[model samples]
Target: MRNLARPLLFAFIALIISVILSIAVGSVDISPKDMLSVIWNTLQGIEGSTQLASTYQTILLTLRLPRTILMIMTGAALAGSGCAYQGLFRNPLADPYLIGAASGAGLGAILSLSIQWPASSFSYLFVPMTAFIGALLTVFIVFQLAKVGTTLPVTNLILAGVAVSSFATALTSLLLVNASGELRRALVWLLGGSTMAGWKPVISQLPYALIGLIGLSVLAYKLNVLQFGDEQAVQLGINVNRTRTMIVIFATLSTAAAVAFTGVIGFVGLIVPHILRRITGGDMRRLLPFSMIGGALFLLLADIIARVLIAPQELPVGIITSLCGAPFFLFILRRSKGKDW
Candidate 1:
């Protein structure tokens, strides 16, 4: 308990600091004092500000706040799901994107984006609904492919993910090629980002994120037991298949919601849980919470860099994560190469 408290406390502080820095260090450069003032004023319903105050307030309310909140939620969801997947498969390399959830969501989001919806109400729900359906379906397909009678092997599951991911990627490319007017926007979104940040996305993602987080946390102990293998877990009174299904469902929900709203941000799940596991140990109970906070802080920092690294010209957050994550993933692979698959 003491050991867990320290990391949790540290993660909380880091997340708060990252949020403040993210708000303060954007293109227009609002100071921390001003950022806090704007938040307070907005919360207290204090309207009207000086010209300078109004400019900062508008940027804060209209842009940075929603962006940061979505960033935090997206980060937590990806990292939490990643942590759950790793525990479920007992594999260090498992992640939502690597396993086809992101690819599936990407395909759905693009399809949604491509369609011209006449009703404004339908427009709001269309992309997220399709993305969630796409993600769930892809994961289901992977699970079916990976199953061998009663037992599901992790290696087979991974291979299935690779095949499915390739197929999804090809389809996405075909769709992008045929997309005329929406080509640029679809390409940018496929590359992954949160530039579309707004209250709408925040509201859209909140419920799914909460549901995934709560569901995963509840199943953490079962995940820990399943790490001992299916036969042993069953002997110990755990229903391995049922737990795995629940974990997959909740994890996919979180991952799909995130990509549906913010595009597909990667390496978050891959990076956050692995690093935290080393520092905090393999206990999912402690690890999941830390991963959530660590993911939030790490991605928020990445988003901040995406915003200010090139000044006015913003880079996609996915590109930044790939730059950092790709190398790290390679290193992990190389180090773990000789061990059992």
Candidate 2:
């Protein structure tokens, strides 16, 4: 209990601090008093309150609020997807990127946007739908390619993912090469940014995310069983192939929905689960919830840095995470002595 208590307590505090910082620190920099007034007025459904200045209110609603929600959801989805991939593959190095989910989604976004698709219909809404479909298709194609004469092999799945990701990346670069005004926007979406997300975007993705959480939560114990080698897992009566395929599908869907809604946010998926697993002893029961909290908080803080580091001119959230995550990844590698990959 004491061991479990620490990460949980730390995560809770980190989340509280992140929310406060996200609300209080922004371009306009609202005072805590004014911040409260805005929250109160917004929650109370009153358009204007003497306590809330209109400028501050706009800053809160239009700028900071949407970005924060986008960060949280993106972070949570990535973290959860990373956890699922790592557990299913029994490889700490595995992430959504390894399976071509992110790359494929980015490609889907680019293809949909580069064309003159209806902004109200497909470009905005169905671009993500296309991305989600692409993610699933990538996974399915990889799975099919990986089958070794009727048996789905993990090794083959990984190799296929690598091939597809490389191909998708090349295609993305091609789109970037032959581009113009709105095409530049498409590239930005591919590179992944949270600057444009808002209430409609958030609401659009809510159902997919909620469904993913519930589905993965139910399969958490099975994921743990899979962490044991396949023979052992099968001996324990878990369907190794089915579990792996389902986890991949569900994680891909969650990831696609999130990436489609926002863009390609990274590292939270790669790092958060490993961090939680260290303190929590690799139990899915514990890892899932704790990872979600930690992921949300991690991105909340990272997004704040992206906002403040340049202040008034936001850095891409993906860039900030990469800068932080790349180093931590090396540290993890060193700690492992380059073994057990």
Candidate 3:
């Protein structure tokens, strides 16, 4: 426990700094002083009594705050699920998207976008709902395909994921090619740009994220036990099949919620947990929470770069993460070549 303290504290501090930077460094910079004044005024129940301009206050409250919170949620969801996947499979390379969840979610989102639904509150619910369903279905199919007489081999799982993900990607492309509504927006989303802004997405996604993250945290001990192989885990009094199912369901829930809103941001889960595993050891008890914090810090910093890298012409946050994550992924792949993770 003592060994976990310093890294956790450092991660939290970094997350705080990233959150501050994310809120402050947007197009119209809001200084720390003005931000504090706005917060203080709001806390005092003195609306419109701040020295800061109204535009700054509105941006802070309506735009940056929700977006920052959303990013943190998305990051935590992805990284927590990724860590769980790695533990469940006993494979260090496993990621949230490893089993076709992202591709399936993308297909669902594109399907929703292809329709010309009325601009109503209910319309906001369709995309995410469909996306979540698609993700669950994809995972189900992949699980069935990968199972070998009641056992799921890591190699088979990866292969099934690739095949199913490829098919889903093809379907998504076909829809995008023929779609008549919101084509550009759909394209941006496919490339990992956020389309939905403001608080609605954050609010809608919160419940799913909470269920998934908290569920994974609760099962962290089971994940550690499962690392010893299915037979061993069962002998140790763990219900291997049930635990595996719960992990998958929880991971898919979090991954689908994140992908439904944030587009298919890659490598966050793959990168964060692997790094932390090396630093803190492979104990899932500590790895899950640390990965959540590290993921939030990472994505917040990536988002800050996305906003400022081109200045006024913001690139997708996914692009920034891919740029950084791709090389790190390659390095890990090389290191793991010829060895079982």
Candidate 4:
């Protein structure tokens, strides 16, 4: 209990601080007093509180609030998915996009933009919905390719994901080359950004993300058994293959939904899980929730950096994460070299 409490408390505090910072410091800075007034006025459904500036209210509603919600949701989804993936594969290096989900999702979004699909398609859920399908299909393909008789080797699975991701990326690039006017849109989706700041975007993604999180939570105990290896897992009455399959499916769904809306944001999935796992021990039950909060906090901070680093002109959120994540990735690689996880 103490072990779980530590990460949870740290993550909760970090999340609160990150969120407040995200709200306060954007292109237009709002003071703490005004921020509170805006929140109060908005909640009371009053158009104007005498003390509130309408512009600040607009910024809070039209920009900061929705973006914050999206960030929280996307970050949690990626982090939770990462935790699930790592546990499923028994590899700390395993990320949510390990099985080509990001690449495939990008390809789907590119295809959507390339075809100039109407927003009315799928009730304005066209790009995200297509991306979700593509991600799921890509992981399914990678799983099938990695299968050998009754067993799946982790090495082969990683290799297969790499190959599929490469293929999907190449295809996406080809579409981009022919994109003409849609090139910027294609590039943004492939690279990742949080330009979709609205309630619709948040609400659209919430259901799939919630479903995936719940599924992983239910399977947490079985994932712990899986860490003991297949023989031990089977002896413990855990169906290893089915559990792995479900983990893949749910993690893919959460990751797909996140990437579909936010583009291919990396490292939240990779970095958050590892950080929380160290604090919370190897228990999936504790690790999953901690990873969720930690991921949310980390990405919120990264997004803040992305927005303010260039002032009025914002960098892609993916770039910030990759810059921060790449070094950490290498550090972990060096530490894990010639050692069994």
Candidate 5:
């Protein structure tokens, strides 16, 4: 407990700072003072009485707030799921997209974009819904391919994921080639941009994120036991197959929900959990929650850089993550050589 306290404090403070920065550092910069003032006023039911300009209030409330919230939720979801995946596979390199979730989601999003649905309130839901469905289906297929009789081998699961991910990526590229008017939009989304604005995304993603995060957290002890290998875990009275399946389902739910909205943001799960695992050790109970906080902090900072890096010309947040994550991935790969992670 003592060992966990300092990191927890640091993560909490960093998360708070990131949230404030995310909300305050957007296009029309709002000072932390004014941002807090407006929030306080709103919470106190005296929003109109605040001295802040209406434009500032509108921007803070209607735009940045929801965006920040969604980003936090998305970050938490991805990181938590990533940690679960790493534990489930007993491999430090595993990530939220391990089972073709991102590729499948991308394919689904492209399909929706190809249709070019008319701009309407309900239309925003189509892309996310379809992307989530695609992710679930893709996972189901991977599981089927990987299953040998009643048991699932981790090696086969990973191989199937890689193969299916390739197929899905090819399909996505094919669709992109034929997608006339929506080409640029589809590309931006594939590269990890939040297309929908305002609060709808937050509302839609909340349940899945909560359920997945909670479910993973609850299963942390089981994940720790599974690290002992499937045969030993089974001898210890753990239902290895059932536990693995539940972990996959929960991790996929969280990952799919996030990708459905934020596009294919890579390396978040890989980066956050791996970093937290180093600090907190391999204890899933500690690693999982801290990864959630660290993920929010990391992504909010990434989104901030995406907003300000080019000033006025915003890059996709996924681009920022990849730029940072790709090198980190290489470093992890090199470090993992000749050692058991």
Candidate 6:
């Protein structure tokens, strides 16, 4: 009962408050009551052709709403991947990028920006698709290199991810070095950006995040068992290798898709899981769900700070999180004595 009670309650409440807060606080001041009424009416079509106020509707439909939904999706995707990566490698310091998603995605974006490629310039949505393709390709290449017969060699997997990440960074830098003015746009994006979340990117991410989250949730029990070390898990009758592979694949897809939309929003994934671990211990069943909620609220609040910190000019949400996370990380480093590198 104690195990189930607190984490579940916190998860539910955090989601509710974050959603409301995300909608209410944005570039334009939106009172909660009016915003709720606007959402209800638009969703229910209570106004029909009468229409909501043009400014209100624009902010609600276009800016605030898309940003909020994107935040939720990105949060789930990162947090989910973070959980999988930490569990997969049995390393507390592990993050979603360990799979090569960020590296490949950065390469793709750098290419697009170098060529002065606007997403609209391509009929097939080249930038995001390119990022997705790069990410999937990295995953493919890593798996091919790391897999031995029917199972993955864990040591090899980690090494492959590191090698891929290093290669991607080198490639990204090389691209940026020779890039013309157009390609330079991607350079900022490579670091990460908060360019307004569009409907296409948001819709594209919805299915991937939902599928990955649902799949991970169903595998939560196996993941929990797998965390007890591979040898022990095998002794307990868990299909250790297969379960690990499934979770790794699941994490890869979610992180890649979300990164395609929101360029490299860091720390939400890494921070949420660690904080949740402190609160709930390292139980995957509790860990995964609570991580999702923590990710959501963390980003939602980060988004709010991003919007307001610079006033009319918004700081990228990733920047805000990094600014906050960097200091906390250093504090952690100091406290860790000789444990962390």
- Candidate RMSDs in Å, in order, are 2.0, 2.3, 1.9, 2.1, 2.4, 3.8
Question: For all candidates, what are the clash counts?
Answer: 0, 0, 0, 0, 0, 2
lDDT of each: 0.84, 0.77, 0.85, 0.82, 0.83, 0.73
**Candidate 1 residue-wise lDDT at 242:** 81
Candidate 5: list runs displaced more than 4 Å: 44-52, 112-119, 124-127, 149-151, 332-338
- Compose the digit string of candidate 3's lDDT tens values, residues 109-191: 67776777878565567767787888889989999999999889889999999899999999998898787566777778887
**How close is every model to the real structure, measured as TM-score?**
0.94, 0.91, 0.94, 0.93, 0.91, 0.83
lDDT of 6 by residue, 1-341 (tens): 34568667777887788777777776678787778677777888765234445567667787777878888778877887788788777776677676576677666655654564455646225555566567768877887888888666667877888899789879888887787564444455555555635576677667767777878888888888887788899999998867877786677667766776677787877777876776767778778877887787778888888877887777778888888877886676577664521
Candidate 2 residues 1-341, lDDT tens each?
53777667877888887988998886778788888888888888887645437677777887777777777777887888888888887777678888788788777766776677545554566666777788888777777788788665677778988999889889878987787766656556665667465577776666666677667878999988988878899999999878877887778867876787567777888888887777776889889877777788888888889879998787777778889988997798788785644
| Model 5 accuracy (lDDT, Cα) | 0.83
Off by over 4 Å in 4: 49-52, 118-123, 332-340
Candidate 5: lDDT of 315? 83
Q: Write the per-residue lDDT of candidate 4 for residues 239-292, one digit (tens) a residue.
A: 887888888888887887788778889889988888666678788988898888
> Highest TM-score among the candidates is held by which one?
3
**Tens-digit lDDT track of model 5 for 2-80:** 3888878888888888888888896689987887778777788675554556677889888888989988998998899
Which predicted model would earn the best lDDT? 3
RMSD of 3: 1.9
Please tell me which model should have the higher lDDT, number 3 or number 6: 3
